[model samples]
Target: MSEPWIPIVMRRDGDRLIMEWSDGFKGAVTWKALRDACPCAGCKEEREKPADPFRILKPNELVPLAPNAMPRVGRYAYKIVWSDGHDSGIFTLAHLRELCKPLE
Candidate 1:
């Protein structure tokens, strides 16, 4: 049998990315790293901070993205339209799986 497809919802809360999966799992992803690795041209150009370095910092420095501008794309591999006019961060199933991993 094929694996069940789980729907994942992504939103911006302040400066962090909030994710809710169909399995009742949820987590918040910060913007600094995501912004640095945005993959979008705008984010790429504006990305001045280092991705790995920020991970060592405290959570207070990180802000969550506001939900007001959260993007909800049509049925498309759990894609999300970023608030900064970036609708390209298509969070694929594999990507989500990686993000859901437990931290060391």
Candidate 2:
């Protein structure tokens, strides 16, 4: 069987990405989560090699953040250009849908 739905619309709400699939599922994902869950190789590598999962960063190293103006990745996926200057991640529809899970 084929997939029953696809994302028909999407928009940014402050730090969140509001998405609605064709099957009527509605959900929102925060920009922070999207940036952290980046599907690119470098981000994946950094996640896997975290020295301390509980470590907190020093304030000076933190960058002010916001999604940049361009956020499209062809017809199959989307990308986010974060204010911190990281834009390598590509958020595919399948992945975004996965992030839109019901609260347990």
The candidate maximizing lDDT is 2
lDDT of 2 at 55: 82
The model with the greatest TM-score is 2
Q: Give the range where candidate 2 is weakest over 10 consecutive residues by summed lDDT.
A: 58-67
Per-residue accuracy of model 2 over 1-104 as CA lDDT, tens digit each: 77646777777778787888898888888777777788999989988994886889867338546788546687767887777678888888788888874422
Candidate 2 residue pairs that clash: none
Error of 1 at 98 (Å): 2.2
Instruction: Give the per-residue Cα lDDT of candidate 1 at 84.
Output: 41
Q: What are the per-residue Cα lDDT tens digits for candidate 1 across 1-104?
A: 75544546665566566667676667666655454445556565556546675456546335443223433344434544544445656555545544552322
